[model samples]
Target chain A: MSDNVVPMKRTGEATPSLSPILSLTATAMNSVNQVILDRMQSEIPLIPALAGHLISGGGKRMRPMLTLAGAQVVGYQGTRHHKLAAAVEFIHTATLLHDDVVDGSETRRGKSAANIVFGNPATVLVGDFLFSRAFELMVEDGSLKVLKILSSASAVIAQGEVDQLTAQRRIETSEERYLDIVGAKTAALFAAASRIAAVVAEREDAAERALDDYGRNLGIAFQLVDDAIDYDTGTADMGKDRGDDFREGKMTLPVILAYARGDEEERRFWQDAIAGFRIDDADFAHAVALIRRHDCISATRERARHFAQRACDALSIFPDGAARRAMVEAAQFAVSRGY
Target chain B: MSDNVVPMKRTGEATPSLSPILSLTATAMNSVNQVILDRMQSEIPLIPALAGHLISGGGKRMRPMLTLAGAQVVGYQGTRHHKLAAAVEFIHTATLLHDDVVDGSETRRGKSAANIVFGNPATVLVGDFLFSRAFELMVEDGSLKVLKILSSASAVIAQGEVDQLTAQRRIETSEERYLDIVGAKTAALFAAASRIAAVVAEREDAAERALDDYGRNLGIAFQLVDDAIDYDTGTADMGKDRGDDFREGKMTLPVILAYARGDEEERRFWQDAIAGFRIDDADFAHAVALIRRHDCISATRERARHFAQRACDALSIFPDGAARRAMVEAAQFAVSRGY
Candidate 1:
């Protein structure tokens, strides 16, 4: 490990921020964004139109930033990761497009979902176009290693999605199973995205594993926080239609925790609501009250905080500087969203 | 070209059949089936369950058979094409799953479609899993050439699907546009599957291009005959729900031909039907009558015969032998399916 100083958050600082990582990756992201825009185009007008709707949407580009930052942390000077990073974003966007269709989502990133604007058939097909384009990009890069990572992660994501569908209105879904789904559907891509950075930089296996662990834990934290914000009612910057999970009868962590701790009466209410019996505004209000009473949101964020810290700690083996500090702070910022 | 004899169809013999190709590819296809069964397995039970619904639904494994037969034509002795053939089938199966979802298909291969049995969410996600698995298999094969062919074909297939969707309700969809969509969505994969056989054999580019032409023409004939069968009252062994294109407003060649040949009153009926107004059994029956009056189904089959002949001619450069004869017979069988 290098003998450079690792920056820590100031004692009693106002809040953790994402600016460090944002500025650190700003220049690199422009190249990645160009690749993304160029690659998403196709002869079919609908392919580019629907893909652009989501690509231009205000996503954080958080996953690719991990790749860029991890590259910086390893002192790599090559520009190949720009295309790789764009491929990562394409994979992510493809999943999001499919997710909206599966969920019958009304809005995404605070706008009408692609499925809504373009219809599900076009949406699904465009998602496929983007996915195939992702592989094409990886093939052009000629990295069997990256192809394996991304392809395996993609399968895991789809499997996780199916698993989540199986667990969807069951009401008996365990936190373990929920976490498994989170790891597969959400964190698998995260881990792959971060791990590819080390591979592109030609770093050691230890560095790759370190970045994988960091990304996986950070992804879990990020998903947990998103789940928390869904029911928090205090978060006004909702990027999707609120109460969508509740209406769709998704067995997320908040519901799982609340149900695990509910009394017989409260349990009956949850059982009814989760079984698709109660879904009006009043029912959602009651569900929110039950969750807040059990402090499940806080418990969920507490879990997120644990993973975010683990993400930061994963960076310690690398040289400490702006790159390391930015990545560490980005982890903190991931958990701080919707606060 | 070797001095081997190319078998021509015997005059005064029985109709051309798929038996030659079936016998030619039977052994190798068993190995390909093994790979497909092995790879389609996943930790998520729903994936295999849903995927198996379509895989075992008794549809002929026509695309992979093309790969195996093309390998024989090229005299490839290796077992690598088995995995690659399975990869081709996986891509085909993935697209079928997504197509059923997109078209809201109720029956596939004369049984309940996967979406009908397993729900759309699982169907879509499993399709994604299988698609990723296809890429994984190709990556394991470690041929960048094969990857490029398959990936580019996949992108074209997706684009074709989107193009077809855009043309769905437009009664003015011309024969040219319909052919373009069919080429991309169906023939592209067929071409890729056949070409990969030459790629793995390390054959000359001439052999690859010839095989590609063979597959592409056969695929067009296959799909054209399928569209013809949908409207032909004389045909019995329909694979999917009849009139699905009619009900869903898909602009296939049959519809385009009938519309093009219709009178003013007939044209209005066609327009209304294509625009989703006329969809009852009576309307479908009347539509069939009008199509028959125009001899659209026969015209469509004439078109198919032209392509099938081209498919057979494309294989002429190869030595005429059992492999060549089997593939040529397979093309004839493809166009003769619903007769």
Candidate 2:
């Protein structure tokens, strides 16, 4: 880690933690959790069956927590954010279901993916159900502005997914393109999830934009660390398989940076590996070695630190309080999470 | 055909036609088509490429036509329905793309399905893009009422689809249950698309309810005819493969009726076929033969005629004129389509 990186805390010896966030939003999150459980049920038994499989699994519920935390940061006292927070979680869950199907994932959150357990058809339909349910929750809130933000973010996410699919297996993908995909597919929802809190709080535009910035930067930093961990063989498995990105030919930041920094011989190996010619465990080991040789994993983490620092900075507008501090620590935790 | 069935028209010399509805909505449909083409585009090339493969395919834009025709029936002068109509079409297209993937179908609208032309990953992602885009369109129109109707309908449709999946391969499925599935998955969208026009028109509650009934019954009738056609060997291939329902073990109305009316030996045969133990062409032929002997195709179409007549009657509250006649005829056509 670099000295320029943001510290986990200004006064404590502890590492950055989500404990403050979890505690800060714990009571409100119960209401949000109730909304999620209530809305996910349907007369169609399979809809709830498939949705509950993933939702009841040990997901972090990070997106909805952002909504709740964002509300506290803005000093909003209303209960409106509870339902809205649940909507955010529903959207995130829907995205995960589709993502697992798209990636053909076997395990998620230390268990079989919904697609694996229910089969792809049921998984996809339940995802659609949850997505539509998200919109229903928003419409119940009756905020046109919130609807616009979330619906637009949803479109951007799909575009990013398609763009990433296009870039898959293409060895020549640039860091810029990878970052753009991360911004859309991951950060857009995070941004929306945080921003909606400001809207419900009746906060000024400045506060809204600040929350958006906080979530977006934190999301990018989070994704960068995730991509780094895929190649970090030293780390324990984090829910998903370690080399999923490698086997799927995802042009993640570490892969992009490694290819950029490689010699002619190393470049040849990357081309073969990224083009789906190399996917064995030995190939993954070699890929990780190449990434480590170029110090790309640390490089990726360094970039994550920059974003995490910005995420903390974006909270400066709010008064120095536990809520803002918790969010800031959460952002730091996002980057330093695996390592 | 039964003696009590609804005739093609009040007068002889022509079968019921979509021509009236088509011509009535023709000019406004151009605008909807433009919106669909423009909005479906993305920086990700594969999105529009995959979407267009299905969009530009020669399928009739039936649902959007409902919106436009409903607008005409209610004398809605504003052009807002144009965008809403496109939104309906986008939802329908998204469903079709997912349906093809779920069914593992090889063709749609007589061309290769988007899933077949593009891979399933791209197809599913493009479907997501279109669905999100549909919401974006609705949000842009800034009508919470319209959003509520469509979003609620979407949730119901997903529930219905999951229900149908649950019903698949279970030969004991009842006609009442099948009808319920059709009402949710097919008729709900129809109801929403037509009702939104009245909402945008700022019409009375009665008018809105009338439009909903018109659309819902019409949708049910449309689905009944489609299900009947799958068993109709005398019918020309209607863009989809004949006996797909049989092979997929879907217990449509024809199968339900044939099974109910069947003797012990025939019941055993259906049990084997619907359980996927029999899937060859000869098995499908036997299934169709049993259906024909039991006169179940006509029975299914007879149910379609009842719904179509109800659909036509729902429009009776509107003034007697071209729009009303066209809608009525469209309902008639829905029931008689595959015959």
Candidate 3:
């Protein structure tokens, strides 16, 4: 329990960094970056202007990096993965743009949200452009199987989003329902990003299945940690306002768990806060206190750790190499973020 | 000119109808309809609920009919075109959903808009899901050429929408710019829908180009008539509020021509009405009177006639048959709609 609770250092002394996979995929990832730049260009000034504002605004490219690493681990040598990885990143960025519009979020990735800067209309339209651009990349890659996987993932993600929206401010949202939403909205894309590498590598079904498992578990773990971090008051590095889920009345894991474990008074408080949608700083503080008192934050983190372990175990089928080790570390890093 | 200006009977006597094409493609179109229903279903109840609210709510199925007619004209005997047609319809429906959000439109096809009924967030997310579903259908079709044409068209459509947004309320929007916007926003999908049929039939490049041209010209004609009808006020059609473009300050061809033809005082009226966004029924009546006085409605309809003629010319390459005649009539119907 103690080992799982200690935040793993991501980029410091006495820590195994993700440099192994990052370096291994450096050349290809650069090409992917260039493709992203090239494709985001359009003759319409507003199209490029609004798209560039979001695309170049410090996205971290975690999903594309996973794609490159997946390709590397599968011993794929072709350049097509670069385009697919770019497509993956474009889809993720498009989702972020839409999410901000949906959430009416003012800030993202430590900057004012694109919708705030360019207005909601431009943000929504440019997000559509980027999404269309992603499909164009997939078409250019000329792999129907890859297109099928990613497209299905996209549909699932949208369904998950609607599911989340329907569950908003509902204190009775079950753990099963929460996991279903997370799996559809987030894990599906992660799984597709890694599984695409196997499709590119022309690997056997077993390999594709293994990578899919790795990504699915890692995605669940990553989302669990994100949900938990919204309640943690540590680093303020969630790229959003702290306790946004609370303010938004989002039915995240922490809230669900806290409600489940709380006494009648606490239950009433949650019901009033969520259903009535009233949560100022003081209410948020009380909510945080309740979360901490029930140890739901750590409990949520423990769930993430459990999924992360499964993610690491799924990588065992691959040969021992820097890429494999880096993927395992990446899964751990997903849950280990404190900042 | 008289033949082109007179309204073609769509579901009445005294003129040819689209029933030729619709009946010819009934089997395939039914399959396409089924595909739309099947794909819209999801475990998440809200997604299907919202998507169905829009999709099942009386869309004319015109675009998918074009795809089917295109296939029929090309002598296609395979079933893949059904899926492709469904995909094409999904893309169109998805765009409508998003466009309503962008336009803040309150009604569509004479019903309360999906965004109003389901809320903007649900509308945007479900639009995204349908778009993804379209891509999945394209992938299932397993034709890279088809995928390329449709994906590129999707990107261009998004760009066209942004272009239209940027040009909104600007009286100085050039005819060339307006045409570009119309071509990108509407004709591109029509062109792709027909061109894909040629691809499915493995037809000659000449046939493909002919179908593409036919669809493009028809789309241009369709949009031109739509723009012209905004000022007509004779029919209770248009699926949206009368003078919607005027109230929204949309730079349609009628407004462009009216602005160009107006005198100094009238120009000031036009500029203030557009730029100031001050529109009431009296103002709308004045604007309509100005348009009628300037002959812009007939002028706009004349432009539509020219495109309809071009659309008919493009179909001459096809051997005359039910499909060919229906397509030619469809082009005429595009511009000849009275309501």
Candidate 4:
């Protein structure tokens, strides 16, 4: 995890937190935070209540950070990215709300999921509210190109969610399908968030695409590490419960890879657990043991490292600076988890 | 119910069907239908399966018809309105899917609600998909103004829905609050749908405002009649079950009006019925009798008539023609349900 060990160019001391990027974009992030609060405000008390619960909830604001940093990296001096950052956060939060309902999870970020507290109907409707608010922000920005990028991402995200729903509990889900889900459900927004910064900078297609590639690869790596963590995360300070993904029978990359490479009897065991026929503590222990024995978590992290490397490489197009270095460290930070 | 009986200027025979305007915008309506079918298409089988269930389900396409008629009335010749009209329908359908989930509706238009057929999660996500697709349509139309109108309507609709949720089974809900809920939940979209026609036609501010007013009033009138019909809809050809609002404890106009004017004993009956404390077949019959005795249904229709008159008056700014006449009759037709 040392800066020397990381393959990315060493521009400064490796900050373990996102604070470097956050401090660099502190003023703009503050504006983005204000915009998030202002937009979720409504005469309907339920909206602000529920949206505030999630917005002020323990979200790292990573998506918006990527946006602000994306804008800053390209030296864009404008206020529009603030609104766009808030929009990105709203989209991400909306997906989380919907995902909680779909996942039927009781907790999020170590607290009660919004759906559990507010009820499924309110969570779903408030998610809709956040989504509409996102579009309103884009429309207020008055950029058709921005609107097109974000709206398409929104659609792709929904499609990815549906695809994941279909793939749930199906042991035959291929690596390609799993990647497609991650790309659309997670990375699509990341790509859009970063690409939008370039759009605001009015940068050329190459820069826009580069930032998009950076965000997309980072998103993939982040999700891979998350999936790996669900099995055995040493970084338990984040408060995410282990084995929730296994209980939910989510086809994360580690499970998919393990199930694909396992012996016939191991495959049967996975199928039974995934099909919810006989899931128990022993089953979880067995699954974790299998994943560890096969080095599935490490393999997943290895894949994540590859993508993280790609994410750092994508930033080579941008000039070296504090912003670019923080972004590169952010990529390294994603894959360095659970080491 | 004839043209002569209506207060609006008579220019043509009153047709109970929406065919007059539908035929006038036949080509545009066709394109809208294509877009609707096209946008709902996805690689995920459940999306199209569930969306097709609701899309091809027995919806009358009334909202999209309004958009088409509104465009034709404004003498718009472009195809953007077609896309806009499709967007309007998508919004309407998206709300229906969510509404079915929220209301726990078993049936829509004499068919099982999408939530019942496809489960709530898929229905909710597909609804999100349709909403995002609607925004994509507006973005493709490249009109920030259009996006503004539609996104605002979407926000209002969600807020209105939340307002209605708060008011559910609460007899203390005032007529003003009920109207507010209706305005946000239904009329706002109508306003946006009609106003967008003027926007696309590049009409003056006066025309845009006029069309917006017309659609808003018509939407209110339409909802009022529908609420009244929930008590006793003589026009039962549409196959909607009577007393659904009553069974669900929905505080529709008739229920609110009757509850406001009822005697002390009757008030208790209504409070208990609406609170689901004593809802049964006998309660429905008594509720119907009470509504009839208090003239609440007629009073509701009378209120609808006033809004219908306003809707017609809003059209006076435009020139008279078959389209205009059809639009005028459409308003009267909204209030002439029981005849």
Q: Which candidate order results from sorting by TM-score in descending order?
A: 2, 1, 4, 3
Candidate 4's C-alpha lDDT? 0.87
Query: Which structure is stronger by TM-score: 1 or 4?
Result: 1
Chain B alone vs. reference chain B, TM-score for every model: 0.97, 0.97, 0.95, 0.95
Residue pairs in steric clash, candidate 3? none
Which runs of model 2 end up more than 4 angstroms from their true locations?
Answer: A1-12, B1-8, B11-13
lDDT of 1 by residue, B1-339 (tens): 344333335568678898999999999999999999999998888888888889987778999999999999999999999999999999999999999999998899888899999988888899999999999999999999999999999999999999999999899999999999999999999999999999999999999999999999999999998888888877776665678789889888888999899999999999999999999999999989999999999899889988888888889889878999899888878777778
Ranking by lDDT: 2, 1, 4, 3
Clashing pairs in 2: none
C-alpha lDDT (0 to 100) for residue A306 of candidate 2: 92
Q: What is the lDDT of residue B95 in candidate 1?
A: 98
Write down the lDDT of every candidate, Cα atoms only: 0.90, 0.91, 0.87, 0.87
Ranking, DockQ, top scorer first: 1, 3, 2, 4
| Model 4 agreement with the true structure over B1-339: per-residue lDDT tens digits | 533332553467454555666677777778889999998999988898998998987676778888888888889888888888899999999999999888888989888889998888898899999999999998889889999999999999999998888888999999999999999999999999999999999999998998999899999999999889888844555557787899888899899989989999999999999898867888898999999999998999999989989988888778778888787777877888555
Question: Which portions of model 4 miss their true places by more than 4 Å?
Answer: A1-6, A9-16, A233-237, B1-6, B9-16, B233-237
**Which residue runs of candidate 1 sit more than 4 Å off their true CA positions?**
A1-8, B1-10
Give the DockQ (C-alpha) for candidate 2. Answer: 0.82
Provide the TM-score of the second chain in candidate 2. 0.97
> Which numbered prediction scores highest in lDDT against the true structure?
2
